[model samples]
Target: MALAGMLLVAMTAWFVPWALAHTDWGNWWLAIPFVGCNVFVACTALLLAFNNSKRSIPLRVEVARGHEPLVGVIVPTASEPVDMVMATVGSVIDQRWPEDRLRVVVSDDGYSDELQARVATLAAELPHGVVSYFRPPKRGSAERIGESKAGNLNAAIRLLSDANCEFVETRDADDLVADPEFLRLTVSHMMLDDRIGFVQTIKESKTSEGDPFNNNELLFYRGMMLSRNADHCAFPCGSGLVWRRAALREIGHFPVWNLVEDIHSGVLALRLGWRGLYVPIVGAFAQHAPEDVANYFKQRGTWAIDSIRLFAFDRFRHMPWRMRLHFIEQTAFYLLSLPIMVLLIIPMAGLAFGQFPIDAAPMDYAVHFTGFAVAMELTMLAFAADRPLGAFVRTRVFLIGMAPLYAASTIRAFWYGAKKKPIYIVTRKTDEHRVYVSMLKAHWFLIAMIVFVLVMSARRDDFLLDFDPGSIYWAIVGLTGLGAFVRLSWFGVDVKRNILSRLQLRSKPDSHVQSDT
Candidate 1:
């Protein structure tokens, strides 16, 4: 599969463009970046498909080795419900690490009185001095979508520093530690080598048999993560990992770069001469994915904005060449959707008018591009979805639905990441229950374009004119995008109904059910 991916990339990226350079539609100036981005995207997909997801420590290595480090688990929150806050704190207290050695710092960026009261009440019930809660100094929440998680975490690091904690583990208010031995395993990696900056673990999510949202990321944890481990390019997953204290100090603590910090901070740590490890422990942490389509787009948009800004700004000069290449491939992976802009337009341009994207034989283009796409898609479906065709298809449809926002993110990153923070919202469970037209606002324009093209082509008898393979190929692709757009909006519409109907059915208030009980 890897060889096939490479061959296909070579053919489409280099061979095809060169072979077609003399053809009427051969536009090298336009094709270079368009095809280049696709190649970069394909390379990343290949990495995810072929790379290893697991790293291991020697079994004989000692834990509780008299030098068991006192670690701080920092849980940051931004106006989340108190119940959600406690679930994470409770998990920290439940860690198998010595109760006295692990400290819980609840850094509430929201400054909610309700959370403060609940956390204080819970602290009284737990072991003496085992839990701590505090609000970091108020700063505007404009950066990194809505709230700056990095800002909250950086402040907590100071507390850890004052206490002389050996290491710190970051967990979002909803990201709960699952594996009791998580600390023991991750700490072992950092301890074995002082130069190791952090150790990341796979975050496992438990889902029902038919998860409409396709929330599970077991594929990423097991596949791409293992690949990063092999390339020596591991980065923190923000929640499910442990960080070395000294390494954080050397890199000047968690960096507030682009829109997110975890990946970029790991990069910064690497550039500062620190290494990271990716452990294949799937049960290290259990976290929630976006419950519905709207939040999923929101989550991915923030990521896309951050990842692309790196290309505009960050030049990784200090990191090793191979490590830098691996990082570049992964970070630029989100920009894959930029090609969708062309996908929507080129076919319509050929069919609706006479302007064709490529003058080459349709069969020639299809042979190369289709082969590349199939090889890439099959790997993701087979490996990423754990052999479930339905899971893979559903996830991909949603990704296709995100084409507009993803493209916007890439183009707008310069303004958003450079001059100002984009007016954006991070993923929230609250968003799962509500419906907003704005969630799919960008999608509307693209959907209308697809419809307009089809209508115009049908009227002009251009739909099947002149044995045009390029027009036909684009029609199929455009139709697929149209379907995805309609399908994603249906999810939003469905959630809207679900919310309104549930609101009408609500004669009572929401009750907090304690999972512990």
Candidate 2:
């Protein structure tokens, strides 16, 4: 399957330039972005193919002989449910590490009195000195307190520093260690290589299979992380990442101001010559993607914006060529929203104005385009061979649905610059699913685009003309737009349940009134 896919990709690559040469370049405005978009797509396809070929080999570590270093478990929380926080704390306490060597620190950025008391109560129940809580100092100015998870983590690090901790495992308040040996296993790898800055384990979602957001996350961890692992640039995801204290100290703690501090820190560590290992083993389980679609997009938007910021960093030039290329590839992956939007728009414009951008036969173009698309999807599926087909479909749906959000975030990041105050939206895990009216309203523009394309295409004499390249292009644009609209507006089972519960509540009053009468 892999070889066949490669051959298809090769064929497409050969055909792209030949087809583009025939394009009407008289319209440079349309010509440039279109050509640029094709080039980016081809390059990305090749890069993925290359990375997918590099298989992950298990690292040999002398676990029995390695020293058990003092590990600090930092759980960063802001406005999380108390029960979730307690569950995470309990999981940390349950770790198999020596009681004296393990330290659990809950970093509370929300500074809620109730949370503080809950942590205090939990700490008292545990062995003295086993658990600690740190809140950003109130006396300092807002800037001094720092903001976002990065700030909370830095404060926790300062508190843990007094404990003489050697290694730190960072987890979200809602993430729980499913494996008792997570710390032991991950720390063993760190002990084997003095230069290993961090080991990031895959985070599985606890949410059920029906949740598209969680299903998408599962696909990413299974597919993208494999590619990243092969390239030795596995991202240190915000949660389920373990770091050496000295390595972090060398880099001046986390990037307190960055929106995606974990990713920024991972890149910085790579630039500074620290090795990062992507542990394929699942160690912890985190709450599924935000139940609230708005929160989901906001979280993704933050990542998209931060990734673009990383791509623009000047220091990336100084890294080894391979590392530099890896950083660029990773950045390009997130910065794709603009390119995708442009690609979608050009075809629609071509169909509306009766100007076929690519002067190629319908059959020839369709063959090449379909071949490339199929091969790319095949390659991605191969990477995620272990995942179910349903998961893969759901994942694609989520990615397609997020196009607008990603494009907006990228543009906003560049326009606002680095000094813009970071926005931190807490992802709440709730069974009560509520749709944001504003989020649904945001998709109106996409729906309008789809409708406009349909209307304009219907007006053309060749609208239903079979074998016409212009008609084909119009169909593709319409389908892409419609798919995006449907995915964005689709509700999950939880939302359905919420709706049913509301109806039940309303009907209960009517039933009681009828019985009384």
Candidate 3:
């Protein structure tokens, strides 16, 4: 809907030549903000385009042949399945790199005895050098929690401290490495240059089933996602990244205060002046929230709220000016999404009641420009969605749907930030198919917005065509945005089935439930 709304306004503006050609303050006042927002988007997109194309480190496999540094892989678990955890650990044991050069550490973050025993059994089966067990004592809150992931990580480093371990890696229990060369590729980047503080590999989804590359929605987000690693100032994702133990210690070991420790660690890395390299190779696969709508939003919202809360604490002052501006651009664009819905609705309401804001002459131009903008935006989105450049037009939802949802999410973020706290919510990683039903619930919101926008546009056609392009663009953007939501909801069902069948869950959804006495 957001993208559609933007397009509508642009088309409306294009029809009025005066709006496009006029520089006089009175004539093109609104055009300034409209064009300015677009210019920002274009510039950012262009910068990312260049960054994505640039080669950071030359790709080579021979770097890991002779002397591979000792790497400790840390898996932090709290109520995660033992079989899945062991499978992930087993994969580490099966690394192409020499077993002598690798150590696996599984930190039990206060789970039940059954879970602890499961991890212990796997730990006993591993080679002598590899040690996997419950977490030990550490400073501050971690000690209180009996070996929290962070504390457990610190403990792992201390245990391996004497072994001359060079790199420390962290990932969740459910993640699977698609390529056996995961350590070889990531550690190679760090080995090539001592200055490089960390190396992060690209992440793919295992449940994507079928040629994972064929999906349109995944294709679109990959650009926005991977571009982060290409830039000089890139944000970090918790999984699929490797850090230097020495560098981590140089900065205070992962601060526990913030709920989103990944972002907190990122801010620290930048401040300490350590270089982070993003590898283009897809070495690992991680699952999204398996079967719960609430789980999905909780994860997304936690990230949104944490970003806002961290910035709210005046952390930007320590960052460089360019980075500060970058953060603001990203945050503002996301935060403004929700409120923009209302801003879009007001003029839409006026059209419904026959009190349109702009004159007919300007409205025509707005309509024209909106069409051009939509075309350009879609082209960019499609290109970004599919890397190495292939058919993008067919995958327009991921591109267009972002506008309204980004706005809505941004508004929600700001409210949470204002409250001065974060809610720690973990995404569920289950194989149960029950989660897909929840997506159907969220889809209703998209349906309502689509209906509202379509009805208003059809009824108030004349006024909408007359007013500035902004309002019209937003109203219609909602309709197009629903396509992505629906696509995701549909994908959820597939994910549930794949996960349940793959894991061999015993209980079926249709089975009768009996109440306890």
Clashing pairs for model 1 are 52-226, 52-227, 53-226
Top lDDT model: 2
Residue 495, candidate 2: Cα error in Å is 8.7
lDDT of 3: 0.57
Per-residue lDDT tens digits for candidate 2, residues 1-517, read 3674576578667667765786767766776887787677667766666665655644634345345777888998887888888888888888777776788888887787888888899878777888877887542456344667777787788878888888999999888887777887788888878888999888877664466565336666766676666666776987778999988999897885567588888878887888888776777787555655666766777778777866764446557766666667667776766676666677667666766656676777677666666666676677557788767666555544566677788777778676674566765576435555567553455556656876877887776552445345434643554465455344554666778998989877554345533
Model 1 lDDT per residue over 1-517, tens place: 4555455455446544543462453544444544454555566665554443333333424357466788888888988878877888887788677787877899998899998888889888877766888888777634322247878888777777777888888887887778777788788877888888888877755444555555665445656666677667788766787888888888776776556788888888888878888877643444466656667667877878777776667866688876776666655556666766665565565556655545556556556556555666655565554436665666666556667778777888876656576664557755444444566765666666767877776777534444455445545665675566555444535666777888877855556655555
- Give the alpha-carbon lDDT of every model: 0.68, 0.71, 0.57
RMSD of 2: 4.0
Model 2 per-residue lDDT at 469: 51
lDDT of 3 by residue, 253-298 (tens): 7655556566567667776777666666665576443423345445
The TM-scores, one per candidate, come to 0.82, 0.87, 0.74
Query: Residue 444 deviation, candidate 1, in Å?
Result: 4.4
* Runs off by more than 4 Å, candidate 3: 1-57, 136-156, 208-230, 287-292, 314-333, 339-347, 360-364, 375-379, 382-419, 431-473, 483-517
State which candidate, 1 or 2, has the greater TM-score: 2
TM-score of 2: 0.87
